[model samples]
Target: MAHDDSVLIESGLQVLKRYASRGETLSYDDLHRELGDPFKGADVAVQVGKLCDDITVQHSKATGLNLMISVLVRDSETGLPGEGFFQLAARLGRLPSTGDADAKRAFVLEQEHRVFMVFRPVKADTSGFAPNH
Candidate 1:
């Protein structure tokens, strides 16, 4: 039987949420491994984008916070393509968005095999969040 798109998306969400909760990065290889058959023959990027949208909506309704997921791909070795790194971020509803800055930082940290940091926004303070790495 063919798996439903919702099933695939839910599976992806579960993996993403787990990593997000731990402040860990998810690589393309990791996602492919965990997602298994559901991800087969699907446009992985589109699926991830959908997953991000779902996460944003669910997170917003549940916590009144904004959720962002970023994906980064780069060259692993001098002549080889690298895998993608996925990162998540949560921010207060009132703060001006820093856009992809935090995501980029998280990607860099993941590339270095360092700790992934989430810079959560604080009320009445906009000086910039701390680096968790």
Candidate 2:
């Protein structure tokens, strides 16, 4: 399988950029809702994670070390990304395979701050998601 949902990837990137512009974080459910709730069944979260991971991979390639996808968390209270985020971060060598909780939280916070800095309206990438650079 190609595993390439380009439409969802494009749409999800827009949603992330929208939230990042406001220096805001969104729940996985929020992303799902914003993406037209295309996913169904128990794997919706997993599917969403895949979408975020895909966007992160492309965004990283385009912008270098920009894991801006940190804006998507399991929920706002926890304010932490799901295991999938950590997994991808590790796989990309951005973080250790099993970093301590504080370390992981710190990484996400830092990335979110960077996302806000780069994607905020004043400094937004007007070229749209993926940047094409």
Candidate 3:
């Protein structure tokens, strides 16, 4: 990314954590609103989506958990992640790129719920990194 990825990842993680605690989801607009300087563009949705992916990858790498935090960030209207999430997931072999809407929606919910379950209060790691149970 042209911007500071670490900063965006940090901010995006904070926001995703808050939403996960509430068992809720947020849109890219909601995420970008709290993130630091926005990327130079007419719309920052693409930027926020990339940040979400980065957060998921970084946190998973750090925690050794396969759950994705990006699932918590979605479109407010459709209540699902943007195409970028599915595209990345497909590239990662998490989902089929040609999956239908229902299948995609199901995948998103499954991941989102998994994210919430993992982030819930637990007696695991307290290293202030990834949440654990």
Candidate 4:
């Protein structure tokens, strides 16, 4: 079965861009409301996880809330550790404040910069819910 919902996919991408641009994070309720769905929590979770696996988005568990999530895009073509350098930093759930030996901060920063390039600037409150790219 082909499990793809263009609406959901675009929404997920926009959500990531929004979070990065605003420097504000999101929880499940935020996504649910944003998605405006008949979508269940598990459905959203599955979609999110699939996006992460597909290198289309990133997801993370928020520090305070187990159900809270942080998401971003992964397949962005911009931002890199120089030419030809690619890291599998897509669909990441969250960035740890510290205590990670994997240098996730640097990776996420790079990914964020790349994602910025993917989506150009728009109006502050405009819903980035379209796949104009």
The lDDT values for all models are 0.44, 0.77, 0.80, 0.43
Model 1 residue 55 CA deviation (Å) reads 2.8
Clash-forming residue pairs, model 2: none
Q: Which stretches of candidate 1 lie above 4 Å from their native place?
A: 1-5, 69-133
In each prediction, how many residue pairs overlap at the backbone (N, C-alpha, C within less than 3 A)?
0, 0, 0, 9
lDDT of 1 by residue, 1-133 (tens): 1233656656666676567546555555566567773444557644544444454445446555433432222232311112222322323232233446565555445433321233322236456887567
lDDT tens digits by residue: candidate 2, 1-133: 1247877777878888888878778898888898889988988878887788888887778677657575555555677888888988888888888759988888887788778778787755667668445
**Sorted by lDDT, highest first, which candidate order results?**
3, 2, 1, 4
Clash pairs (backbone) in predicted model 1: none
CA lDDT, candidate 4, residue 19: 74
Model 1: how far residue 1 lies from native, Å: 23
Global lDDT of model 4: 0.43
What's the CA RMSD for each of the models? Answer: 11.1, 7.5, 6.6, 13.4
Report residue 83 deviation for candidate 4 (angstroms).
26
Which ranges of candidate 4 are over 4 A from the true structure?
41-44, 52-101, 117-133
